[model samples]
Target: MKKYLLLTNEELKRTAKPYLIVVAVLMLLEFILTAAITKMHEGKIETFMRENGVSMQEAIDAYGKSSFAQVVASGPFLLILGAGMMVILISAFVIWYRDWFGKTNYIYRLLLLPGSRSSIYFAKLTTIVLLMFGFVAIQWLMFFVLAPLHDLLLPPELFERVSIAAVLERSGLMYLYDFYLPNFALIYLFALLLIVFIFTLVLIERSYRKGKKVIRIFLQFVILGAVYGATLLVINSDHLFANEKGMLFLAFTFLYLAFLVIIGLRTVSKKITV
Candidate 1:
């Protein structure tokens, strides 16, 4: 347990301060952007509502729904891009960091210590997974926080009509849970699975003395995509009914993650240099 904590501390120290700063800055920017866009376009929004088949009263009654959907959708794409870039940046850092540590002599030094290599690998792997998960959670929370502020900027009656709670009750939460949540979870799991596989590929590539790294990575991606395509074909065929689609996908995700973890462990446990 103490060793795990130490591993956690090491991983936490890897990019904690920089990552936090970036997250804070991006969240603040998103919040202010949403609020500012709302306020700035409030008049135009009212005009659009009036131009549409709605009166001022009706516009006021349907603030976020009728007015802010376009802006909200496009504005949040930037946040999504930012979050994705962060994930890639951090994942690349982890891969490079391992090689960096090896070059710095810490690889041999740490391996010589009274600890299992599996412990070290799993600790780092767990840390990276947790960090990636935290990144996803933060991005979602940021978008969620920004979403309602547009409604908040409207008049009281407008806000009352497009209230976040009302939106949730109407169709948002249903659509989210029914349509978006499962897919998002699937994508998140896919990203985590990719990261684990990439880590294993890196370990394997590094085991070689020559220029097999790029070839190995390319082949790995090809094989991974083929596997994913085959799985999707199976899922989309007779395996899943309409009512059972979401559950099937969710189950497949859990099973896939487990498979990746087992494969990762097996690969990492084998003979490999740092």
Candidate 2:
């Protein structure tokens, strides 16, 4: 257990700099963006009121009030969000591939580490989860941070101010990262399944090499397909008069995760060569 923690911590340490850079860059960019967007809209309102000789309220009525939710919905803001996701997607591979393809083959050292090789696998998986969830937690809090910034730039009368909760409620991200406890668990559970699925694919590819290339690729697809196929069948089996489809789906998910983890551990321990 101590070894696992050490491995996890070591894995996290490797990516710490880049992770922090990405988080800081995104937050800074969003902060600047929030201010710029506020300034631009405020200017528009001022211009319209001056040109037409109207009151601030009248100008807002004519042009509509700006809200934090609207700012987030803009193309530029969504692009920033996409940039964060892009880093995560690249990380999914970089975390493992770099160890093999880096200046020296770090994989040799990692696999030979003094403990169950499963520790290495779990360490990498845990690092990915922690990095991802850290970004999410900070980004969630960013709404509150930006809310005041939004209100600070414009007066209450000019700004369409809403509670942080209301801002999230109106935003699309609320669907994925729900404020409600139950849905939050379900959403993150599926997210973990996705990361595990990706890890399984990478591990399987790294472990086997003797077979014909085409055949190996085909088999990889087939095995991955089985994971998804079983999952879908369970979820869609309600027409067969299953007692509780949700519970069945959740149960099958846990079983499938175990199966994949077992495969990954065996691959790491026995199949992979230094």
Candidate 3:
């Protein structure tokens, strides 16, 4: 366990910089775009309220109130969503490469070491999962810095009307500290399961190198399609036994992952050449 931890830490040390740099730059760009959109919409709000025969003070209040929602709800929220998805997508690639490339590069170096092969795979998988969690953390920190600016242009009465404090609280921004660690762990676990599924497919391919890699990919696609079909058939047809439909699919996937893992272990243990 100690050796596995050390190995994961070593891999993270090598990979963190490029991942951090790319995610940071993309987040900065999101913040800038959101800021620009907020300013433009603020101007439009002021003009529209003035033209509607609103008194100067009322127009000012109206413009600020309307624009505040846009700033918080539309601009920053949408950017946050995009940033989150990008981080996840990039994290997926990070996991894929860590297992695929990282293993291959140091294959002989580590394979000959007197350690468990499954331990090596699990350690690399754990490292990739944690790296992805770090990616989510940095993304949140980036957006946290921009949240205050979202309220900067709002009038005091407008803030009171919309209840900015309660709004922020409900929006999960004020309770960020409370939710941060939990959400990070939740998302990390979800991502870990998903990537493990993908890793299972990859290893299943490696298990049958006597056939073309394309064939393995095709097999995975067929399995995925079959799962989708079975799900749709169960969901669309009322006659399907509800309990059986759900359990059968879950049992199938669980068995599938187990089968792939077993195949992978045997292939690696047998010292098959690709």
- Candidate 2, superposed: residue stretches over 4 Å from native: 210-243
Top model by TM-score, which number? 2
| lDDT-better candidate, 2 vs 3 | 2
Instruction: Give the best candidate by lDDT.
Output: 2
- Model 3 stretches astray by more than 4 angstroms: 49-104, 138-144, 157-190, 201-211, 231-274
Q: Give the TM-score of candidate 3.
A: 0.66
Backbone clash pairs for candidate 2 read none
Worst 10 residues of 1 by lDDT: 170-179
Q: lDDT (0-100) at residue 217 of candidate 3?
A: 64
Q: Roughly what TM-score does model 1 have, to 2 decimal places?
A: 0.68
lDDT per residue for candidate 1 within 86-185, as digits (tens), equals 6654664464355446446555654565655566666677666776667656755654676666767877644333444343345333223233666666
Q: Candidate 3's residue-wise lDDT over 77-170, tens digit each?
A: 6566557656655564554355446746565555666777676566666766676566556655655565566556444433323454554555
